[model samples]
Target: MTDQISDAQFTARTLSEALPYIQRYAGKTIVVKYGGHAMVDERLSAIFARDVVLLKTLGINVVIVHGGGPQIGKLLDRLGIVSEFKGGLRVTDEATMEVVEMVLSGPINKSIVRAINQAGGKAVGLSGSDGNLIQAEKAQKTERDPDSHIEQVLDLGFVGEPSAVDTSVLDALLKSNSQLIPVVAPVGVGKDGHRYNVNADTSAGALAAALGASRLFLLTDVAGVLDKNKNLMREIAVDAIPDLIADGTAAGGMIPKLETAAQSVKHGVGAAVILDGRAPHALLMELFTEHGAGTLIS
Candidate 1:
């Protein structure tokens, strides 16, 4: 009986601490790029859905953009399709694009929507192609040869980047009194009627900027950006991000995530955070507590 009473007291105190944050974020929009281990682990996924629903219950508009690269690859292998990567992006041909869309828009998108709905939230699953939400053009990349410094534009077939984002559908759903959460897949349609596989991080940043979101949260595998000694850097100025990349502090997949975060902040999103998705309730802790869960770039 005494322990039960103490637990109740702790819950009340926690709620009291979260009150200010709840009020601060009410009626604002936040974009979350949900991926990494959180998507695969059942326990983590359940808690993530609950956290998102809690945010919605508090009157915060939340947009979820999800990735399914591994799933897509697995399906492609099962179907006997060969694929490769260029500049860390899958070289998506027509056949590969079909599978990419199948995985991202079908199973992954619907699963997240189902999880949120089961958690007592109304979630609408959408692909970037739905309602032309994300208009894209073929992406062009340049790589220099290591032996000789010659830069050449490499054609990444059917792989595209977001050129413009139309938020009318999202705005209608969010503004409606019914309180619908939008879960978007990153498969975009090109101007020429071809479906393009877009990077989820890029799509989330673009959508956040277009919506003028209050914050953009990228749930990644790592804790956050780390210093040379591998300690988490809690805060980073937007302008200083480039130096981190040039100096090798941020390399590999982290470079693109940082670039997206910085671009989102510069283009109109209030701020961006890169936090570990593996940690349960990291999103909630980041938003509600004084000390956020990850590196903040503003």
Candidate 2:
């Protein structure tokens, strides 16, 4: 933190320079997806919580959608529950879905809420099931067997994607209430009253789109979307993501994040950025500085 900026004078200058940005985003919504390395590292988590509190203090309506994959996996291991994956998505059955909900909505969600509250902000933890914030349907996919060369359906039990989202809960929270931040777990409820495990990044993107949020920030481990040489591409047009994915530049978990970011931007989100959550105050750097902190896809 000390090295990022020179000294106190620079800090003061940064605050002075950020007045316009502060004003520009005041009363606007920003949805932050908190996960990856940031969720694990104690120091990073504390920093992120403070950053969120600061954003709210500045009148930026912040909605946090958080992921707890590693935590869930850890607990599942403890319980001796077998976990599986199809493509990059988790294959969540009924038993695994129970663990997902327990860890995500119970401990992890409240922990984040507590962190923000301890940092002097009012935060309410929620799941997508609360108020039917997200209506989910089973996610579908197909893949070809290498030897058979025939595509077959891959059934990931209980896993879902966002079918619809209701923002009445958010409107009541963000617009009609006191100064509050929402920390949401990615768990969703199906129309048939079944619980579905939704991917956090996908859920966050969908929520951002539904709210017409000013910015959707996906804070992850990497610097941002990189090129073939792994150089960070500072700014990207939404249309260019397919080429990057096709050329194999975006792979693994990053592919979903890129796809989500592009889709959010297309769905009327003001801006979507993939940035390193490992860095201290990374959100502040991106929002307030001239040279931002990550790859911004507008």
Candidate 3:
């Protein structure tokens, strides 16, 4: 089967298939939350950089918001910091926040920016702290007691959600460089001069909503979403999410991704997609192909 079609035929077919998508999103903004294995694997990371360059060259506004949970954990372990989690939110104390800021805003952010630049795209690295791009409030959680079954507020220190996203900086960057891609680190600043560690997915969703982006991509380890039977569900509606979560089909970290996607859609972004970043050129396939790369929630 592979020998049947020549390279020229494949190229032509791919371009023809992508024409409509390119037209639909030629000047639209796309926010991608890049993480998981895709961020760690060198080969996949290079491919991602090329794909981002391709998207920017095609006239799309590409904003990359990334997660460094695994990286952060590794650093914490190296520093002998015993980390804790409450309701899936990291217990980011002042010390942990320091490491988080350095890791997210320093190495991780610049690396992605450099990758895109090397791939022929103008790229900038930013943290929410820069220009107060993302103003956040301390995040709180509630958990039910197993014995008393009473809800109690749990303090998840230094963890925050976006209260406001100021896109002026992003606008300035975009205006100055038509093909610029911004790689954002999910670190926010509070009004009180405190730095907060935000969930990458939530941060990306907030940015997308604020920008009215055409799509928000949550690039994960899994292939889009799977049913309880482990079959891929190509598309989901915002209203259908609660039921899916209640029934346990949407489990673990995926629950938060879906929540972010639904919120992004409701807040004005066209759609939010959960796609497998482990797949080569997954982001490209999601944007430019007839058969998309993931499960879309709109």
Candidate that scores best on lDDT: 1
Candidate 2: lDDT of 246? Answer: 89
* Model 3 segments more than 4 A misplaced: 1-5
Please identify model 2 stretches exceeding 4 Å from their true place. 1-6
The positional error of residue 212 in candidate 3, measured at the CA in angstroms, is 0.3
Worst 10 residues of 1 by lDDT: 83-92
TM-score for each of the candidates: 0.98, 0.96, 0.96
Global CA lDDT computed for model 2: 0.92
The TM-score, computed over Cα atoms with residue i paired to residue i, of candidate 3 is 0.96
Expressed as tens digits, the lDDT of each residue in 1-298 for candidate 1 is: 9999999999999999999999999999999999989999999999999999999999999999999988998999999998887756678898998899999999999999999999999999999999899999999899887789899788789889999999988988998465799999998888887889999999999999999999999999999999999999999999999999999999999999999999999999999999999999999999999998999999
Output the lDDT of residue 214, model 2: 95
Clashing pairs in 1: none
Q: Rank the candidates by TM-score, best first.
A: 1, 3, 2
Q: In candidate 2, which residue pairs get closer than 3 Å at backbone N, Cα or C atoms, i.e. clash?
A: none
Decoy 2 TM-score against native: 0.96
Clashing residue pairs in all predictions, respectively, total 0, 0, 0
Flag clash pairs in model 3.
none
